[model samples]
Target: MRLLATAAVITLSSIAVAPALAQTMPVAPSVLPDGTLLDVTATGKTTRVPDLATIRAGVVTQAATAAAALSDNANRMSAVLSALKQAGIQPRDIATANVSLQPQYRYEDNKPPVITGYQATNNVSIRFRNIAKSGAILDALVAQGANQIDGPNLSLDQPDAALDEARVDAVKRAQARAQLYAKAAGLSVSRILTIAEGGEIAGPPPPMPVYRMAAAKAADTQVMPGESDVTVTITVRFLLK
Candidate 1:
């Protein structure tokens, strides 16, 4: 119908450049259809600020004996835990990620390896609910013997609701596209033959970029959480009459 065509065009225009994210999905029907099979695919996008951040921080110590290395690491680890608590990191937010003690070896050609010392490493995964204070917390952790800091894996604490919104948008986009193709071919959309959900970014994004300001009034680590993109794509097969 004319109204259907107009609505389809309106929907298409609302999502400018969205066509670049999708194409006609290739599909074959199991049974012969009385009408034509028109396939359409579309993507939906949404932006959200990250609500959770995860960091891996720990200490590394080396000593001539394994016992000595373990003892030193434990003492340093205690200070690190205290610092985390002082930074308002809840006990539930702190988890031991890794703890290991390995022997240091010196290797030479045509000779057996020699034991040099023992290396101890203890790392904890720290989840920060207050992202703004993470920079200051890292500084405090460093002051308390945390030598290795790995992340700030930023993510949405509750992504299910956001993902559902994207799904609705994607379905709307696909439906509009189907109408467009049917109208162009002098046919009417009769029914939806198939609905298939596509891939999505379901996990935390890569670690954020962090920096340490030295020339400023307070030399401390800075954490920046820019906007993250949540996308969903779907393919719909329409029976055109």
Candidate 2:
């Protein structure tokens, strides 16, 4: 009787440990003896017109003292802002980007660096909803005392529509690639098993600085609205039969 009881306890312990062992096991994919997986690449691109313009303009002033320099910059920037408003730019479209004041230094042989004067700078960022007026607005700003002008970055205001089109193009491209691979391998494509997306190429260009204002060069600036390009790419995995 004692032997029978020990055997029963041993049986129950083995059953409990079996569950733990099964939980610790790793899963492996099942495949046919001669089957193999293949990786393929596809590329797609689409372009659309850009609808917005972004530019940076501001004033730089020099004076005998820091306070004087700052005051001068403030006065000039005020005029520039007023001019932009008169040119039909909404108040919300103009933003102050940077305000800096630094002391000017003079270096001479056998002499320690000395404070010569002070320079102040004020920069404003402007976003033009209408690309047509980009050049005119820049010209007006220059006339109002904006000595530094930075890029008129042309870009799409709403990119969702363009992205949707690009996605469709990417799928078509992937399908073509899968077909080619299937034909080459003597296999037929059954269906797409997985699809992965990559970054879009339709972003705005890097900021451009116009440097000297256009008004300083021409009485009326002429702006050309260059075309913008947008692109997209996708990766697709297809199951073969």
Candidate 3:
């Protein structure tokens, strides 16, 4: 009984000391100083020639019945896929963007709408690594029964390097502005307190001119991949002394 009473007293003492130990531990400071802080946002932009192209090509077929329309669309799409493969586009680079079969309605004056026929559409998005040959590939797709073609959205395959360059520029600009502000206030920039990225990394710009191809034969298309601009924005907080 005496030994049990001693053990119980020791456990109680340890429990009482735990909170004091925690209180004695040091905590890292969240803010740099209790001084004035300046927050600045800066954007940096860089232009680069696009090395990649994304093409959207598809086939649309109309028939009296949904099955016939779908069948015609499938056959045309198959030919388009074959042409893509022949143009050196890998299977992984091609993806189905959309597929739909809808009934065509004919509206008459003061009369109820009537279903005339069904139209089927199948769209595929293709990523072309070789930008130079993209035009030729598009021409081939048209030859292979691709009635609808949109875009050759030009972009960079690896945008990280460009974005990193923009980030460096942004930081430099922010620091310059901070120094200017501190000097104007008769103070010096002590140190950077924190940095946060803001705004979206700009995406590939819109295609320059939109083109619509009919069922008629088209000559070799000429595609001009112009330069694209990449922009980055950052917010920086600095302590003034």
Each model's RMSD to truth, in Å? 6.8, 17.0, 17.2
**Could you give candidate 3's per-residue lDDT for residues 1-241 as a string of tens digits?**
0000000000000000001111121232574366666777777666777777887999999999999999999999999999998888999999999999999999999999999999999999999888878888888888899999888777677877877777798788888888887787787888986767654354544455334465765455767766666666676777777
> Tens digit of lDDT per residue, candidate 2, span 1-241?
0000000000100000001111111222364223333334444455655567778899999999999999989999999999998888997888888999999999999999999999999998898988767777887888889999887766666766766676687788778777777787687777765566654533444434333344546555544545544555555656666
Q: In TM-score terms, which candidate is top?
A: 1
| Model 3, residue pairs in steric clash | none
Where does the lowest 10-residue lDDT sum fall in candidate 3? Answer: 5-14
Model 3 spans with C-alpha error above 4 angstroms:
1-32, 209-218
lDDT of each: 0.76, 0.65, 0.73
Ranking by TM-score: 1, 3, 2
**Candidate 3: Cα lDDT at 131:** 80
**lDDT of each residue in 18-67, candidate 1, tens digit only:** 22333444556566578777667677667778778889999999999999
How many clashes in each candidate? Answer: 0, 2, 0
| Count of clashes in candidate 3 | 0
Query: Weakest 10 consecutive residues, lDDT, candidate 2?
Result: 1-10
Global fold similarity of model 1 (TM-score)? 0.81
TM-score of each: 0.81, 0.76, 0.79
Query: Model 1, stretches more than 4 Å misplaced?
Result: 1-30, 202-207, 212-218
